[model samples]
Target chain A: MEKSDEALMLQLQTGDLLSFDTLVKRWEKPLLNYCYRMVNDVALAEDLRQEVFLRIYRSTKTYRPTAQFSTWMYRIATNLCLDILAKQRRRKETPIDAYLESESDGFDERLIDPSGAPDAVVLKKEIKDRVRSALARLPENQRVVVTLRHYNDMKFHEIAEILECPISTVKSRMAAGLERLSKMLSEQE
Target chain B: MDCRFFREQIVSESYDQLDADAKKSLKAHLQTCRECEQFQVSLNETQQTLDQWEEVDSPIDIEALHDVIQPKPLSLPPQLPAWRWLAWGVAACLILTLSLSVLAWIGVDVKWADRGLTLRIGQESVPEITEQELVRLLQAERHATQVEIVKQLQGALDEFSKQLQVHLEERQKQADAQLVLIYQGLQSQRVQDLGFIRQELQHLAGATEAEFLETQRAFEFILASHVSEIQKNMK
Candidate 1:
């Protein structure tokens, strides 16, 4: 039987490095996706994911299984992302529209269909670009709630735990987010 | 019933989180309410639209990440502390003195005394030398040894100075990087704090405006009531 994450964590507390490796492997992709959605930059997401893992490794000695391992991991990731976003906001380095334009260009080049279906691929890319743009335009709080709920498929309570907010707040944010998303998506149409 | 409440219920319903009773109530309301029904449809459509944004596989290099996270052994040997090096130098001097003494004790005519070294190679060491000649010879040898020792010390000092300069430069670069990071962090924190304060001020302003309007309405009602009472007395 596979060891539970908590069991692996316990082993890690005992200095079993193999357990750490296992935890990393299990979590890296999901974390990568979460970070990618949060930052809206692939390179930045990768860097953040690596940072999250490094933090987890460094904090192994003090790690407690008081909560689910995933919750603690996500808390670390969410903080790192929020910190980066805050720094970016202060710098005002890349405006959202400019970032979207650059990203759309890359998407156009990278998402070409290998099956020789250019029209279908273009339509799909357009839809995806619209969705990504709308998601990016949301306020950070609403965006996080939406992303955690919709993309990560986390329960409202679980999201509440991760965000350190009340479940009602999470739901309200989700509702507000979806309402705005509905308007934005329709506007695009 | 306010449709606004039902809209929140719709959102919960869309996520399949509505309990049976709430779901039944929402269903009954949606049967008669076009706006709430349309909201539910729009939310569904939005979710469907988001589904088009597929998950891409992560391109992280696990091996590289593993290498980065793992504790690495020191590539270079650990540097010795200055005191250890000093102790080793003292031990080397003592060893050299002991060897010289052994040679002298074995009748090799090598004598090391009062920081001066003397050596005679063969057993035929019965040469008659004057005390002044001996003193002159010892002084010349001592002066040569002092010059050589001074040269070696100067070389070691030069090397040590260079290493210290390099180390200080590296430390300066690291400190500069840390300062930059600290400045950026502080600036970010300041921005966040200002934003929070601005939001609080706006909320306070909104509340104060509402309270002022309510007080004005109360005063107007009281004034109208007084005027009616005076009109009745005049009649």
Candidate 2:
């Protein structure tokens, strides 16, 4: 049976290096996806993912089993993502154009299935691009909530824990995020 | 009931987070209110659209992360020269002899025989050093020297490894930047190719339309001439 994340973490705390490796392998993709949606930049998202694991490894000695391992891990990732976003804000960097440019830069080709019909492929790519752009336009808090709840499939309460806010705040953010996304997607249509 | 509360409930219900009691309440509200029902439908549609943004595979692998995180093991330094060890041994012997000589001068009797050195101070005899004891002392000194050499080597190795890691990371960043530039160039070229194709298609379409019009005009004239010829024959 696969070890639970907390179990693995506990083992890691006891100096079992393999447990850390397993944890990294297990969480790498989810964390990468989360960071990618959070920042909307592939390379930056990758760097953030690496940093999250590095932080986790360094903090292994202090990691307690009191909370779910995923919660702690995501909290680290969320903070790192927020820090990067805050830095971008300080620099007055507008990422909307960058997001659009990346979409057109053949990066979306990874998301497209080549075996599909040409017309269907094109249509799918267009819709995906629109969704990504609409997502990027969301406010940061709402975006984080939506990405965590919707994309990561975390429970609303779990999201609250990760964000260190009340569950109501998380739910309201989710509602607002969905509302905005619906409006923006309609406008795009 | 205020629709705002039901709207939030609708969002929760869309995600299947609503309790059974809250779900029933939301359903009853949705049955009566068109706006809440429409809100749920829109939220669901938005979710379905968001699903198109599929998860991408992480470009980085675990090994790369491991390499960055795992501290490199300390390496043993190169072997010390035999001459250096000889010089150290000689210096140690000289210091020991000088200390014994000083002790002898301070009203102490020192005797050197085949067994080892013996000392007597005021008719009280000190323990003699046996061959085994002397050999053990020399071995201990050599071991300590070896440990110190190993420690110095480890420190140097650690420094080199750190510098190498920084250099590697810098190079990796440079390569990543170059790759991004190349990718952007390709994207722009693709866009330009698409624009050129679009312009060519428009030109071809215009020429096709002009030829079509010319053919239609000629056909009309030929039909008119045929009709006139027929009328004349009938007259």
Candidate 3:
């Protein structure tokens, strides 16, 4: 079994650069997926994921092992996404998807299941696209909660900690998000 | 559990989020209620669809990350030539001696006595070109220096007082602005709350009116039916 992420972070805290590499390798993809879903842009997601690791390394000296590694990491990533959204709001930029749609060079292919037969692959791709599109349509608050719950498989209490909201609020948001997602998917059908 | 309770628990139950007791109750209710069972099926389907949306294999550049985390090799300072080293040494010695000489000139006596080199203030009074002229010049310079110092202090005091006043005014303005903002926020919140309360009251009143009208219509219909029944019986 691999060393746990907290252990790796502890090693990093002790100035073990190799352990930092190990952490980046482990967290980069999930963080990338999270950023992509949050921002709905491939290039921006990749950039934000890179920044998340950089910030983690920068803060390793002050990092305490009080919280779980995943919680800390997710909180960092979540803050970065929120910061980017705030900047976008300030600049009054076009919607991320509007740009993404124009640059649509198979951005959704990141979720493709490669081992399936051609027809099965196509159908799977369609389902993934529909689900993702519906996810994209949710308000940012609902989107973040739903994605954390579903994509990251975080518990409601963990999400509450990350969001700094009450567990009831997280549950209500999740239910509301899921209900809206249900309606959106049904409409697509 | 009633259908409403089961409906509320459906999402949690489907995701195994409910406690064992709640789960048991919800499951028992599910067995009895067709609508809730259908809701559970749909919620599970929604969760499965969400699960199917997996992340793709997008490779991160580990090399780039290495560049960020890798420790940089330490570089040694370049070796100086002998003459350059000599120059630096001479410069450092000169600066030290210059500072020492200036200190000695400032009334500290430096001497080579019988025992060794000694440093002291030997004379209580120094002979100038003219003692009177020197005394007058010294007194004049001292008075000028004192006046300049007093002026500088007063200027600093005035500037500081102005700055303090400005700072206090700014702080007071900020506090007042914050108070106004808070008051406005509370006012708007009160308006929103009142609006919501009024809407709820209106909705309740409408419902009560509808119920009263419906009851009155039902009473009238009953009276008409009873009269017709009696008339037919008497006939």
Candidate 4:
């Protein structure tokens, strides 16, 4: 049975180590998907996924049940990934050591994104990657608002709270980011 | 609503967050306007296409994470009192400024060269000195005294920063008990009596040495004045 995010978090705060392990299992895939899309590096995304959980551990004392647990957890992850990206801007973005379709991914094309013999899905992912690459090139705030909204399916109010922006502002940024992405996608097409 | 108004509304509408009136108006507009309806379709398709971006899950090596965490009890630094942490941080920075000054006095050129490094210094060298020649002779006797006095000050400041880092680690270690005490004090303080918001600003200031020192003094001065004011108010 699926537990409510709040309940899982309550269990987590009480030092139920198994709750944390379960939370990690529950969230690891979605969080990785979100992070991997944002960062475009498998290992860094994995590393960041761990950092997100570790941060959850560190911030357990401060965690409140006022918001959904996924919101709280992803907010921390998004912010950390954004910070990593901002720092990385001074040098490089790709983990140069891990980009050659990592050998750890054995020779199964389905493994890359699990496209079940659908070329459209594969192409769509390529387009997604291109759009993401373009997004990383945009200003940080724009990238985050778009990621939180379009990718995470967060409502404008939730995104505003996460970003601490007015709803109008989040809308403006998402619109602007999507506009830019439309241009980039058109160019790629 | 004008087309522009409805157009702007469409983006949020696409998010499924629009109110009933606005949603009704937009739906009506889409029914009447071919352009908007086609635009809505394209937007919908784009979102569906974005589904491909979701990451395929990866297998985790729990043993690796357990390896990192199992070594000891959690190694997180104990949180400190704002005033004490600020004080030690400033004191540490001042001490750093003095140490970097010393390393400067030890010399920047030869010491750097001996460490198998290179620096682009005196870009437009004097008439007698080519940068290449100076770099080559940096280790020689002629430039042995090349350690400039001003540079010595910088080395001392860097040394201070290094030492301060050590002190901060020790301070964090030593504060374990004191933090427990202060945590108790805060816990005991009536919530209405005091309110605090902790700010962790990693981007304290500019990266340059001179800028860093100025930033340190400014923060220290700000906190010191604020603390004194708080004490006065309490009295």
Cα displacement (Å) at residue A24, model 4: 0.5
Judge the docking of candidate 3 as incorrect, acceptable, medium or high: acceptable
Taken over the whole model, the C-alpha lDDT of each candidate is 0.87, 0.89, 0.83, 0.72
Sorted on lDDT, best first, the list reads 2, 1, 3, 4
Q: 3 or 4, which is superior by DockQ?
A: 3
Each prediction's TM-score versus the true structure: 0.62, 0.63, 0.58, 0.53
lDDT (tens digit, per residue) of candidate 1 on B54-150: 7755656767877887757769988999999999999999998999788767867876788797777767757899999999999999999999999
DockQ of each: 0.35, 0.45, 0.29, 0.19
**What lDDT score is found at residue A24 in candidate 3?**
80
List, residue by residue over A119-139, the lDDT tens digit for candidate 4.
865665566555555655557
Clash totals in order: 0, 0, 1, 32
Best by lDDT: 2
Score candidate 3 by lDDT. Answer: 0.83
DockQ of candidate 2 against the true complex: 0.45
TM-score: the better of candidates 1 and 3: 1
* The best candidate in terms of DockQ: 2
Candidate 3: misplaced stretches above 4 Å? A109-118, B1-8, B31-35, B69-235
lDDT of 3 by residue, B103-212 (tens): 67787877789999887864667555788888999999999999999999999999999999999999999999999999999999999999999999999999999999
Q: How much lDDT does candidate 2 score?
A: 0.89
lDDT at position A57, candidate 2: 92
* Cα shift from native, residue B197, model 1 (Å): 99
- lDDT for residue B50 in candidate 1, whole number 0-100: 93
